[model samples]
Target: MERNLMKGNEALAEAAIRAGCKCFFGYPITPQTELSAYMAKRMAKAGGVFLQAESEVAAINMVLGAASAGVRAMTSSSSPGISLKSEGISYIAASDLPCVIINVQRGGPGLGGIQPSQADYLQATKGLGHGDFQVLVYAPSSVQEMINLLTKAFDMADEFRMPAMILADGLLGQMMEPVEFPEAKTHQIPKPWATNGTGMKRKHNIINSLYLTPEELEKTVLDRYKRYEVLENEHTEAETYLTEDAEILVAAYGATARVAKSAVIKAREAGVKAGLIRPITLWPFPKKEIVKASENAKHILVTEMNMGQMVDDVKLAVECRVPVSFFGRTGGMVPKPSEILDKILELGGAE
Candidate 1:
């Protein structure tokens, strides 16, 4: 089927509905408000629930309640709103309920601006909330990728029995592009542990984050980490470009990677060997792929819309084998291809 043009936020909303997402709970915030608005109009037509909660806090908790009942559920917001939902996210994580969350990020230290930014890298991949838990995170570079990720986001949540996040920026959310939706998932693995009301034939189920005994909590945490290790090994994904014989390797994600790829092409045309590695999944962070991509490179550059949040992860992956440098544009500003090329040239990448 031919694809249709759509804004990233609207595409994601439609994708979630097609993914069999039965419930959506969210509070409106800029850059992401269109997502909730789209859901409000379409979800009801699809026989699903679209709720505009009073606050981010209330919305996330409502998601928790619905997901625990074995229904596919979701919530979305921007940076500050995501911060408000963190506590509830941690609770959902601890309770092992499955749900999808979207963060169409904006500038921030505090209510920074409604403009596009990737400042929430650390927050999404690292310390989203207080716990040893890790959520699967996907960063989509375009509106089409947003649809693909949003559809898969629900299955990942259900398959792992944990929260999964679609980490996008305001640029992707606001822009429009052609996108195609895969057919609705026809078969889903049943979640027996869900707190569906018990009938007379079965025992009652409970879903809660509390662990009154330290020993019990310790065991639970350890078990969860074991599961994460397995997930990290199996799910890490990234796209590599021109790395086979490049001298300088650029690492980026989301919309920034698209810009970096343009610079890489320009560099190659100018007789400079440059390549790119765009991480598709952020949490299981394609570490080995990055290490390998830098094998023949003279230098590694990490570009972001934030002040180098993901650079730390890149450094850890590179393991000091090659020099790693960072260039960024914060406060809602995005870097252009020429700007990234300049940084590449400054790193002695010019041939």
Candidate 2:
């Protein structure tokens, strides 16, 4: 396995291609535009389709169509662009189509700034659209993790027959790091429900999200949740660092997690019993791991590159067992290791 120095966004594009993604439909948005550019330059040579759609909504719908036809498909966007694609994401969820979406986040409530932000945590974890549906969300802290997760995202999407998202920040997209791609994987079995030319042997397969009857919709929603439960049990992923004897725990994810981990090491070196629990999968959220890590912890500090979104989830997971505090940097500002270390020291003394 050889490594290559590449930007996170470009690494993701190459990873998608190696993962056998057959189509990429995306709109160019800052911090992530390089991803689409990479795909545009290379997809044709890989014998894949790369179309820069007119708009984010159009791009996502194209992904939906490709996935329904049983091909690996993907789309990438920033925060504002992701908002535009929400409707199509919901439709894909309802249709149970497999596709990958990458959201390299920027500050937002409405196009706030092009700088990196983790403000989309709530949107990605909670249903991003108008329904009771979930996308398996992976938060990658490093360029390597970005490539790794994007590669796995395709398989996860196909395995569950749903959309999977890579929730990255603008910083990760712009940073360059060494990454090794996994060997390309092939689908072992055929998708029988795919509407990829019936060949007259089987009846026409219908791919749709429209359930006209309320009862039918209810049943579909219930069934989808049942599958979500299975995913929760099987796909929860997290990383625990020096949590065994720690008195303070730092809960973070994505780029914030990288900074938090550095603070943890600094805090520990300064004689503070600090540790970190980084959620890799934001959807299932590794509640089991959080609870387990909480056993030896006295206080939990949730850090984010936004104004405290994932902190709520941390509180829910901790369940009043320990006090949860939040430290945030909003509007695309990233927290420094020294700042987080200071907070850890303050929390350590207070607790």
262-328, model 1: which lDDT tens digit per residue?
Answer: 9999888887889999999999899989988888988999999999998889888988888889999
TM-score of each: 0.98, 0.98
Clashes of 1: 0
Candidate 1 local Cα displacement, residue 210, angstroms: 0.7
Superposed model 1: Cα runs more than 4 Å off? 184-187, 349-351
Off-target runs (Cα >4 Å) in candidate 2 are 184-189
The digit string of per-residue lDDT tens for model 2 on 1-351 reads 888899999999998988889999989989899999999999999999999999999999999999989999999999999999999999999999889999999988797899999999999999689898999999989999998888788888888888999999999999998878766564524689999998989999999999899999999899989989998998999999999988999999999999999999989888899999999999978999999988999999999998888877888888878999999899988999989999999999833
The residue-level lDDT of candidate 1 at 43 comes to 95
Candidate-wise lDDT, in order:
0.91, 0.92
